[model samples]
Target chain A: MGREMDQEPSVRTDQQLIEDVRNGDRSSYSELVKRHQKGLLRLSMRFMKDLDLSQDIVQEAFIKAYEKLNLFEGRSSFKSWLFQIAVNVARNKLRENRYHFSDIDDVEIGVNATAESSLIDHAVGNILQKEVDQLPFKQKTALVLRVYEDLSFAEIAEIMQCPYDTAKANYRHALLKLKEVFQTRADLHTWAPETNGMFNEMNAKFAEAAE
Target chain B: MTQKRFYADVLLKQTLKKEDRVRIPTDESFYEAMNNKIMMAIESSEVAPGNKWEKPWVFLEPGIELNEGAGNLRSRLSSKSK
Candidate 1:
């Protein structure tokens, strides 16, 4: 359905779209937003985890990217450049939230894998925004870029302006920390299949080793 | 299972609606807001942007080395350099 909609000529080619947006084409800008919003929101969620906050981050990132578009020399893919901007916005949000990522393993607990629980759950899928919000800034950003954005470590490093090792390490650390958090936080003991699966699987192994 | 699936779908739909409500202008106003921000950037001072928060955490993967599960992570990091 989306692909059919995206085929419209009004959207323009990627190169054409960039030129138009840069030249102040409103339709072109709207098309760009249409093409990128869903992906960018998902990316922001990986960082901020909150649907509202992720949407806000993507909105701010788009606004900022538009502001900076004139400075873009197209050194790399425009998508990569845009992604770099989103990461910056999300990371800034993370920092502002006072994330430390310290000793998250200490409070690890098993999560509930079932999302079939309540009216609120009936209202909004399982909200992991809260859990993701608690992740350390870099880890959350890295995980968002890696898993949600499916970006390569090299791309992430370029966007993050960090060593590739740093980006990869950040991602790994973030995953491990999340694993720990889901396990310890009973409130999250059953959030989603993916979360609880990883949570229980990790703890189940831990129990085995302890015995 | 449909009962489980139904609530899941409902929550997802509601969340999606919530997300839509949170979106900033994507219509004509979006372009205008963008132009204003760009004009500000154009008119403003130019300085190198660095990480706004670059505080060094005292522990840098210190605890990671102790955990057996983290070996894969350590290896992944090292591999990035090579």
Candidate 2:
């Protein structure tokens, strides 16, 4: 019973987790990584577009964040603070390797698509992904953080190290560009009908964020 | 969102979901690997006093440029050598 209880995720908050790690309960560090790694991995993949590179960046980011844990001031949630480190590490890896996020050709349509139009949805998704991947870096990051990660503009700004308005503008610009892209496509109406629910959700979220 | 914006947002989000499916690791081993990596890194590095990091070379607050001056010094020394 004691062993099983010990195996349970630390009941303490993230702040307490850090305190435990500081107190030399090193296993707590592993527990903390388990708690946060999935989100960090997803965020890293959005930025890097390569699983191998994303994994490396997330690993390095976790290590770096662990190293710099003392600097954390509790101003932001630990998750956001860790994201800041991961984002910076990912950016540095991209710069140092002279790498660019590749076009969205590799996207695999998720299982969430209704079965009837799975093929068509897959094709449209690929096209849209390509456009998003090609967006200016700032706009792409903002969109990913806002739309995909479901982060608020304030958090997006903190992660991107920009003014909140700047983050909002980047997301807005990204949407405008996508609007232009789809408006000119002849089959856009068909695709749009299939995606109405998604649009409604996106709009609702955006409105909520704006408020 | 306006009508056009709605369509764009929907399509963009769908595409993002696709990317998320392809890229995020969902397997058990992924976390295990991360845990191992963290353990290795922490073991190899010198633990700071109080189990906290040494002061970062650059304090990030505005108007703090102490670390920047170090870079400037390196450049100047290189220039003198040349």
How does model 1 score by TM-score? 0.50
The candidates' DockQ values read 0.04, 0.12
lDDT on C-alpha atoms for all candidate structures: 0.54, 0.67
True contacts kept of each: 0.00, 0.22
Docking quality of model 2: it rates as: incorrect
lDDT of 2 by residue, B34-76 (tens): 7898788877654355334443232223222222321222333
Q: What is the TM-score of chain B alone in each candidate?
A: 0.27, 0.35
- DockQ for model 2 equals 0.12
Model 2, range A78-192, lDDT digits (tens) per residue?
7767877888897788678967644445655454546637665666766777787788878988887777776666566667777767878999898878766654565545555
The list of candidate 1 runs beyond 4 A from truth reads: A1-11, A23-26, A45-55, A93-131, A181-211, B1-82
Write down the lDDT that model 1 would get. 0.54
lDDT of 1 at A84: 77
Q: What is the Cα-based TM-score of model 2? A: 0.70
